[model samples]
Target: MDVCLLYFEDCPNWKVTDRRLVAIAAEHPEVVVRRKRVETMEQAERVGFRGSPTVLVDGADLFASPDSAAGFSCRVYRTADGLEGAPTLEQLRVALGLTQEVTR
Candidate 1:
């Protein structure tokens, strides 16, 4: 699977997301995560970048939002705990279909 991590340099949350993505990718051999730096507003708009640390699986946003406007900004995630800078590890695993059902 082609996973792209879109983000701006100024966004601090991207680093956190990147680390998690790396760890997840290590577990899934088919997953490949790429970093995309959105430097300009026009580039952001053209690439459909909702905000920094936007996780795109197969060129589509994993957690797509209809109301979100494409631009260079910090992205927030609604995790189980609360609003977070990045998605939780479990969230990533679930989104990427890495979670396997235990049959015991």
Candidate 2:
């Protein structure tokens, strides 16, 4: 699985996202992670870079929002606790399918 993390240099939240991705990759060794910095508006528009820290799971947004405007901006995630700049570690694990199924 190839994962691309689209980000901008100015956003601090992108670092958090990068760490979370590495943590998740530890469990899924098959996953290859790559980072792309959205430097200019033209680059953002050309590659459809939505914002800083946009995780693309097999070329699709892991957060699942295709309706979002394409630009260099910050992204907010609706997590279990509340809105956060980045997805939780657990959320990332689930997305990578590295979690075991346990009955509640």
- Report lDDT (CA) for all predictions: 0.87, 0.81
Give the alpha carbon lDDT tens digit for every residue of 47-74 in model 1: 8899988998888887868889898778
**TM-score, predicted candidate 1 vs. hidden true structure:** 0.91
RMSD per model, one decimal: 3.2, 2.5
**What are the per-residue Cα lDDT tens digits for candidate 2 across 68-97?**
878877888878678898877777766767
Alpha carbon deviation, residue 36, candidate 2 (Å): 0.8
Question: What TM-score does each of the candidates earn?
Answer: 0.91, 0.86
Worst 10 residues of 1 by lDDT: 95-104
lDDT score, candidate 1, position 84:
95
Give me the runs in candidate 2 sitting further than 4 Å from their true place: 100-104
Compute the lDDT for candidate 1: 0.87
Choose the strongest candidate by lDDT. 1
The true-versus-predicted C-alpha distance at residue 29 of model 2, in Å, is 0.9
